[model samples]
Target chain A: MKIICNGTEYEVGQGTTLLHFLAQLQLDPDTVVVECDTEIIRREAYEGTLLAPGQNLELIRFVGGG
Target chain B: MRIMVHEQEREVAAGTPLSEIAASFPGSDLFIVNGCQVSGAYQPREGDGCWCLRKGEMIQEHELRRLLSLRHTPGVQEVISRAVVGIMGLGGLGSAVAGALARIGTGRLILADYDIVDPTNLNRQHFFVDQIGMKKTEALAANLRRMNPYVDLTLHDCRLTAANIPLLFAGADVLVECFDDPVLKAASFRLALTDMKTMGYVGASGMAGFGDNNLITTVAHRPSVFIVGDGESEAKPGQGLMAPRVGIAAHHQANQVLRILLARAGMLMGL
Candidate 1:
């Protein structure tokens, strides 16, 4: 299925959880806020939330530097 | 058609651009339309209102609060005065954000930072030479007091860990993450967003170096979560953080803070 992450389209396998998605992208769950289709997904729910086709995800990464 | 310019309503052509209206009233330092900054080329629709702020105006201290209230959209300053904003870092972005909030009469601020003012921070951080060696919380609090003595401040001079983040900023209406360390920055923001779900989050990333001011911007990851910065620049060996770029991001964070507060108060319905 294709899902949009941070404005970019990506194809992931079926039933791909947000946690696995982050691991594939090398993004630590503790570092990024994931918004799926305009709703912020709770950090604890990352494992249960499945990425659906055409889902618009906004992943805001907190790097550094003031 | 009629549009508001400050306290008075002015008759203007149906599609008169904001630039022409602004030009009619000379010496205005800042222009705000419908509670947000708009380009001068913007064409104001009927019923759209604006405030054209002028600099160097003298007013008594007792009148300061009243004047500030009058300058903004009606009842907006009241919303600002009831907000409690938390700042997690006291570096360039944090300091400028704090200063802007203080100047605008934010009700309270919760400041947390472990570092002290160092000589290298002079290029971007909001500290004077005399403040060197002083804890950032103390130095920033002192400076903020000068801007608005009435604004309440709570200082936590210790480093805010993921464990202490929730407790330190329990009453904050919003939290701004402005850490300089990548690991700590990511950790703090994650903690705030997950642990403090009630408070809005404004985190900055990739605000470094100079040139291309437009690259720095504000993005809403969620309705209550905002991130401001270029999303790519980093303070590396050759490219260091400068005041201009850092200040721009800081102001964006500060503005987002106000917008969130006002939106929560039912003032800015557009947000």
Candidate 2:
């Protein structure tokens, strides 16, 4: 299954959760806030929510400023 | 005797004795001693062969110590040190926030408060009984300097006023809104938002009351901000700020600052 994340495409296996993919990419969970499609995934829900194929994901990390 | 100092492919001649050779290159901190990896220390032998001192190579002990002391990430340190961070109200939340940033090597800190350290503050403010009569900023800066001699700290021994808000945060990189008063908190938010365009600053609110561990949440993004200690959450009207809860929130705030700075430098992984 193909999913787009941060403008990059990945061929993921079926029933892959966003959290699982993030872990596979070695992304730091503490640094990033993940949004699946248009909805923001609460930190508590990252572990449980599975990603559907062709999903558009946005992963934004915190940077310096106010 | 002539020694060779290599920087990339460029090699320059260094005088006899390692000390003399090292003195010649004023800006180069990295060095190589003999054939082994050494930094900051090099003693020349009587029968000296061509000793090579190269940038990015190991150095003798003396030089090594100096190099180690010099912050390699100068740009990051400069930004942190020169940047002013306003922490409102030096109570439990303010105390923790001030100390954490000072200890972590923030160059300059602006601590604002109008309270005296009360006897009760000892419970969580990390202050001694002798500090009760002293102003919060004075005591806090004293403690902060003791924690990190490198930090430059300033104190505003007064309340946050609308008139002084601009002066208080003139060059501040970020404003940490730890005031317990809801009115002041709202005021600070307004001040930050209005000046953010001019000062390039942002703020975090919501650290008050108790159950600190539960109150804390890590919020990241460009100009990362956090609201710690459930200030927005319900708490008893008369209940004062607890140490553990306020301390946890303060820690979260400090960590977010450091993480934001690191992220900006592209040095941190896992925002």
lDDT of each: 0.84, 0.61
lDDT of 2 at B157: 88
**Candidate 1: fraction of native contacts reproduced:** 0.63
Give the per-residue lDDT of model 2 (tens digit) for A12-44: 998887778889988655434566775666555
lDDT of 2 by residue, B136-202 (tens): 8888888886776556777888888656878876776666766655545544544443344343333
**Can you write out model 1's per-residue Cα lDDT over A1-66, one digit (the tens) per residue?**
999987889999999999999999998787677778867787779999988999999887765578
After TM-score superposition, what is the CA distance of residue B139 in candidate 2 from its true location, in Å? 1.1
Model 1, range B1-271, lDDT digits (tens) per residue?
8887764788899877787888866876666677676777778887776766565665455456755675674588888888899999999999999999999988899999999999999999999999999999999999998888778999999988878888888889999988898667776666655667778999889888985999988987558888899887888887799999999999999999988998888777877
DockQ of structure 1: 0.36
Alpha-carbon deviation at B13 in model 2, angstroms: 26
Instruction: Point out where model 2 deviates above 4 Å.
Output: A1-66, B1-79, B198-212, B219-225, B234-239, B266-271
TM-score of each: 0.72, 0.55
- The ten-residue window of minimal lDDT in model 1 chain A covers A31-40
Fnat per model, in the order shown: 0.63, 0.01
